[model samples]
Target: MLTSFYKMHGLGNDFVILDERMGALPLTPDRIAALAHRRRGIGCDQLVTLHAPTVQGADVLVRFFNPDGSEAGACGNASRCVADLVWRCSGNATPVLQTRAGVLPTSRTPDGLITVDMGAPRTHWQDVPLAMAMDTLHLPLPGDPAAASMGNPHATFFVSDFGMVAQGHALEHDPIFPERANIGFARMDGPHHMRLKVHERGAGMTEACGSGACAAVVNAVRRGLAARTCAVELDGGTLRIVWSEQTDHVLMTGSATTAFEGTVDLAAYPS
Candidate 1:
C-alpha cells in the first residue's frame, strides 16, 4: 500500500508524519523501525501519526515513535510540528491535541513561532518513576543529576562543558531509570541562558530535542542554576522555555518547518 506522509521538522529535529485520521495504517514495531532506517527507508528522528481524537474538545490525537520502534509518551518538537500541520489543515490557530501524556494546548505566536503548553513538570521521584524511591533533586549518581518528567523520564546533568554526548548514551540505559530516559547534559551560560545536548532514549543524539530542553530547564530551575524563564540552546536551534509561575505550566516556543511531503510504498519495507 502507498502511504502519504509529510516531512516536517522543528528546530532541525525532523519527523516523517503519517496522518491516519481518515484511515488506519498497518504500523507494527518492525514496520516503524524499518521506516525509520535512514538508508533503507524514509529517515527521521521520529515518526508521528495523527488519529481521531479520543477525548472531547481535542482537535486531534498525536502519537510519537522513536527510531527503535519504541512509543514515546511525549515529544515537544513533534507537538509543535503537528500543531502547525493541524493549523494549516483546519485553519485553527489554537489547537488542542491529545497524547499519551495528556491534553496539550498549542498556539501561534505573533512572530509566527509555535508555542506549546507542556503542562506542569512532575518532580516527585515516583513521578519521574525512578527504579526506587529517592530524592529527585539530587539522585544518588556520579554527576549529581536531577530528574524530572515532562510526560517522559529525563535526567539532566549539569556540566561545565557540553562535550559529554557519549555519557548520555550510558546514562540513558542506566539502571536507575525504570524505563529508559532521555539523558541531557546542560551547561549554564547565564541565569537566563543554557546550552544543552540530549541523547534521547530510543533515538541517539539528535540535532534538537524539545522535551529534553524543557526537562533541562526545569531541572536547572530546581537547582537554582537558571531562572524560571530561560533560553535553552540546543544543537539545531534555541527554544524559549518558561515554567510559568502563575499557571505552573511549561511553555515551549519554537519554529516548525515543512521540509517536504511525498508517498512511499509500505510493502517495500519489511514488517
Candidate 2:
C-alpha cells in the first residue's frame, strides 16, 4: 500500500510526515530507519506521524522518530511543522498536540510564526534522568556543563567560542546520561542572544534543533548568563525562546515550511 507523506522543515531541520489519522500505516523501527536513510530512502532528520488524538483537549497525536529509528519524547521544530499542517487542514490557528512527553498547545502569531508551548524545563537530576544524583546546575564534567529536560535529556555547555560541535559526539553518550542526551554547545553573543549547535541523540549533528535551542536558553538563564527571553541562532536559522517566569513554561517561536508531498510504499523498505 502507498502512504501519502509531507516533506516539511523548520529552519532546515526536516521531516517526513505521515498523517495516520484517516487510516493505519505499519511503521516499525527498521522501516523508519530505512525511510530516513539519506542514501537509500527519503532523507530526513526525523520522521513524524500525526494520528487521531487519544488525549482530552488535544487536536492531534504527534510522534517523532529520529533518523536512527529511536522514538523521541518531544521535538520542538517538528511540533511547529505539525501545527502548521494541522492549521492548514482544520483552519485552527491554535492546535493542541499530544505526544509521549504530554500535551502541548501551539499558536500562530499574526506575522505567521508558529509558537509552541513547550511546557517547563526539568532540572532535577532524576528529571533529567541522570545516571547518578548530581547537581544539574553544574555537572561534574569537562567545561562543567548543565543539564535539563525538555521532554528529552539535554546537556548544555557554555563556551566563549561556538566551535564545540566536534565535542557533541562524545558528550552525547557520556556515561552520566544513561539514556544518552542531546548535546548543545552555546556561545553567548549577548545577555539575550546566543549561538548554538546541537548534536541530537540519535540524529547526530543537524542544522537546527528547536528543543536544543530551548534547552540552551533555559540553561543559560539558570546559570545567570542570559535573560529569560533569548534569541538562539542555529546553523539554519534563529529561534526566539522565552521561559515564562509566571507560567514556568518555555515558549518557542520559529518558522515552519513545506518542501513538498509525495507517497511511498512502506512494504519496499526493510521491516
Could you give the C-alpha RMSD of every candidate to the true structure, in order shown? 0.8, 0.8
Predictions in order: lDDT: 0.94, 0.94
Counting clashing residue pairs in each candidate, in order, gives 0, 0
> What are the per-residue Cα lDDT tens digits for candidate 2 across 1-271?
7889999999999999998899878999999999999999999999999899998999999999999999999999999999999999889999999998789999999899999999999999999989999999999998999999999999999998867778888888899999999999999988899999999999999999999999999999999999999999999999999999999999999999999999999999988
Consecutive 10-residue window with the lowest summed lDDT within model 1: 161-170
What candidate 1 gets wrong by more than 4 Å, as runs, is none
Spell out the clash pairs found in candidate 2.
none
User: How does residue 122 of candidate 2 score in lDDT?
Assistant: 96
TM-score of 1: 0.99
Q: Which ten residues in a row have the lowest lDDT in candidate 2?
A: 160-169
lDDT of 1 by residue, 18-44 (tens): 999999999988899999999988999
